[model samples]
Target: MSEKIFSYLEVHAVDHCNNNCRWCNNHSPFCPEREYAAGEYIPWMEKLEKKGIEYDMISVMGGEPFLHKNLTGFVLELRRRFPRKSLAISTNGFWLGEEQIESYQMLWKLTDILFISLYPNLLRGLKDGGDVTPLLHKITKHNPHLKIDLRQKQTFRMIAYSEEPVEPNTFCGTSECTTLLADGRLARCGLGGYAGYSPNVGEAFRSSKHMFFDLNRKFSKGEFWNWRRRWPFDACYHCDSYKWRETNWKAEKGKRRRLDLELEHDRLAGGRLMALGNFTQAESLFRRTAEKYPLDAALCNDLAVCVSHREPLEALAYLAKALEIDPDHDDARANLRRLRHVLGRGTENARPEVCSADAGVR
Candidate 1:
């Protein structure tokens, strides 16, 4: 058995989630109903042990892990099988009510981290008016042994599939990790597991084409290593969160969005640099700003301008995102028009509806 310990291994214990969070990167609501069979994991674990495939942490996740009636049994089996590995679970905290306090106790007692995602909309409906202090107090009062991980809601980015594929190498947080889907398909990330999409690594790279393992089949050391090394795999092109890449269409237009004033400075500085024709400096500044203000159409447009001369394809993608965010963003539309023309892509049949946006200039 290899003694190498992986950083993380996420297992989707349940296919469907309790909450229909619009920004869910896992696209849980659309996922088909499926349950992870505990029995199926035993042989797999045995194989891993025999091959020395080890991990420091094992995340038992779901649309909601608690929704599974057999979760406790499965978790206990995992403890018995991988006694030295740390156990964890991620939840929305919607179903962790007073009625399930006992169950929560058993779960929290067994796991190293009880990651609770605090959705603001859900929090507002609480008896204490969205305040977590009382809830935390109640939970701790009942289960002092429980370790809580309260993750406050923020804008979560996701990329939509593009008609024209572009190779992406951005750090998508799933690098070097494995995700076991509910159907026993083990993938490097949820995108590949569900969408059959991954980065284009080349025809010779078998991992790019297969992307995951059929746990029902025989497991091997070669399969494990192949899955582990297929980072930034071809299927990655389907996910923007993999690298915070902008989508061609807006996925969150009607929803209320958040932005920070601190990022405005970077955009302004980047815009100033763009006006001076310092595209390299502007590109760096805008890139930093876009990381913080990804949904901001103005910032995306500015960044597009900065990169237009050096990387027109990237600029086209950015402009597309700008138009998607603010469909009325005329400047972005114009920039897209000009770039497409330079690229020799005809604008005659490429007309988009009028959009509203400032000229993306300082």
Candidate 2:
């Protein structure tokens, strides 16, 4: 047996979404771009097949995979391409109906797991308004062999640009994910696809007509293992998704220590620069520290003061950013109100220059 164990393949078949959920991390409701091409899907599958690289599970997700014009055809192709592999799809479960359930018969025959997203507010009382209950009942009635994985819709807050937290036990980390984008990029994780930060799988497979023999060669060798291992953990650490749930109980204190070290580094660096009267550098360091440690109101207040001395007009902007990061920053709030008064006075009289010149002397 080959010691090599490959992870699940996550394919983003469509970029468009219909529901505008409040807690969506990827900003799916606001997503305006559609990059998936129906014609290129089969060829991409074929390329993966040619590689000895067989996926343990193929996951189809998007704004909603059901929204794809050729969803039935796509599911069929996935079945045909990966005969032995299990198929899974994540959906908001909005478009499922009696006819849709009938269409799913083909998928039920081939699919092993059906991961349905239950949006409580969207499907609260309506019997047929995208509720997975009807579909689950129908699917169970038809195919007892299929395993159903019903997941509750959880809030994913974007703490940073790259990371967001899913519910506990939901995230399996990068080791268990192989994400496929419509543009022929293969990501190490499903989140990477939504974040537009995945690695390139191969040359763009344009259509199903062309045989992607070369593309197959690229995916066959598992070079992505090394790539995934090198992915920055700092980006994720600052993410709201890196919550207490994801922390390993054994390594909790250690992880907290590391995070504290990172925060301390930023704090010390910012403080040293501020003491030296280098407001610009200090401001940059403090901004990073604020993002990582949003609970630190002192950092926010201090950073606000540094920016206020240089750019009084930007004082409000920095203060606002600080409060957004740390709402309980009383010092920041008080300083912000005071600075606004100074700004008003400056506008009426003369624009106040930053004290960078006299800062060094002080």
Candidate 3:
């Protein structure tokens, strides 16, 4: 890669992971089973070299790097080509076994750092029945020189696509990700990279070869590295972020979690408008979101807040529905008490509280 391109770049050994994590930004679980040949990256790297791009590190990661058919050979070639480049390999030991010890040793000897993600499922005797946990400890025992970065992933960043109106210029925290996916496409980040692969994301932004940056273009370092135009095909409206629902870390197994993702995206969008005192737009958004995701109590609570001003009775019905769905809904409960007090005082026009997403935008 060119010095002008970036300091970091990631090359996946494969895109299809054994664990289908829902919060995965890369959308690994959604992708088909395929191993990336080291040869595919040669021209991409050479293009960067031609453009004078140099990077500080080249991270080798995967669905699981060990799943790659040509594991040792792949990194061996990368090490040969860029001997000075720092190589880091990220893996979950699900695919690793006693049989692959020699290959693991060779890999440990070759790479600078080994990142092991100790997901709860892996620790709780999942899949391989606690075989992987012990082998992870052995990495340092044998390869004393290799660095081990262990990550205890209890929480993950949520990546969701909105079915709502597009916002055009949304710059995400993930835009800084500079990884090349298994399809030989170098993307600004994994979220944009898995355009055609991710369940909801594919539907939101249809993937095309053109969306993937043209490596053949005679673009300068700044032109090559410009993230805005390249990511999400000009407008980043289809994607947005908000409060993540805290759920247990388990595999979605490539299941579509679109409804909840869209719920949060649309609800949060309405919440933002509610914060700006744009109750009209917020009301419209919340009602539309409710039609899409009717059973969610949070949406009901949020919807109640917006409609409270013009339709106190409708707001009461919405809040009642939220409470009926989830009796422990604190915001709905709190809004109900406040709404009742206003009615008892005969000041029904008084805006109660925009509780829930906006935390009662008064």
Candidate 4:
């Protein structure tokens, strides 16, 4: 991580988030609750010091940073270690109402910035039907010196799983935001760090590919730099950032979408099933869909994800066919790239035996 000086480093204080925002790329909706102790990450920082890595600032965030009961202690410890470094806490502010003003006042001394991201999901995710307005007022009353970055979402976009990925035009928000995970792993961004954590919520994370830095294990600095310059982590292709147009965020309490994300399209119905980790049903549907539309690149790509673990060769074939139909299919291309990288690296059995690649479709 110290290969280059970073503007700021982001760390998740809690594994699970309080709000299930549809636009979130953090995979928070699917993660379980776990507050990371500051002690766990202290060694990672010490390692960074030993390796000559440098970062200008540290941002404490999480599924929701406020979920950690000892966040003050955690931040206090970070401040104790890096007293000169700028510190920040990014949160949804859902728990602000419950915070003791004195606690935050004490936090004010350690924190330089307080980032609050407001998503419409807060209307429902709030406890006992409480709102953040009172919390906002309380903060305003304190006149805290920490810089406040409160952004009420006006338009929102999502990162979604799609077999047929669209041309990526969306800006990479995390391009410069290197993330540090609790296990002493450094990731290019939040998605890369947290994508693997989502299988607990659904099959989507399980079906996707991710990459990270293992400072605790063997790694190639050259490989890491090369991987950094290459395609956005394979998970980037699964992002709906560019596929779906940004929609106006509806803030009206009565009109907020239910907790379940609405299906964006009927043809991609299998995706919803896949979201629930229903690969068996998704596989059946995708196979049937591919049989009907053999040239459909999207269906081929979906089928590839469904069977990649069991029938790696067949998965390769489906991905190849998807590329054959549309050479520029980013989703299929990403899946193929993942296969090549994984099989080439082969964490298991030094690469599984792969037969010749052929979709063998009727």
Clashes of each: 18, 2, 7, 5
Question: Candidate 3 residues 24-48, lDDT tens each?
Answer: 7667778777778777786687667
Query: Model 3, residue 40: what's the lDDT?
Result: 76
Q: Candidate 2: which pairs clash? A: 164-241, 165-241
Winner of 2 and 4 under TM-score: 4
TM for candidate 3 is 0.60
Q: What is the C-alpha RMSD, rounded to one decimal, of candidate 1?
A: 21.2
RMSD of 2: 20.2
What are the lDDT figures for the candidates, one per model?
0.63, 0.53, 0.65, 0.65
Clashes of 4: 5
Top-scoring candidate (TM-score)? 3
Q: Which 10 consecutive residues of model 3 have the lowest summed lDDT?
A: 94-103
Query: On residues 1-362, what C-alpha lDDT tens digit does candidate 1 reach at each position?
Result: 46674677777777766555554556565566567766666665665677777778888886677666567678888887888888888887654333233334445557777788877655554556655666666667655766788876644555555544566756767555577654556776665555522232122322355567666677677776776776666656544555664322223333332234224435554554555556776676566555535457888788788778877766777787777778888888888888888889867348643333343322
> TM-scores for all candidates?
0.59, 0.51, 0.60, 0.58
lDDT of 2 by residue, 111-161 (tens): 677777666544553365545676678877767888888766554333223
Off by over 4 Å in 2: 1-4, 22-27, 33-51, 128-135, 154-158, 162-175, 196-222, 231-240, 244-362
lDDT of 1 at 33: 58
What 10-residue stretch in candidate 4 is worst by lDDT?
A: 258-267
RMSD of 3: 22.0
After superposition, candidate 1 runs with Cα above 4 Å error: 137-145, 182-184, 196-210, 214-223, 245-362
Error of 1 at 152 (Å): 1.4
- Candidate 4's residue-wise lDDT over 300-358, tens digit each? 78888999989877887777777777777888877887886766743322222322233
lDDT, model 2? 0.53
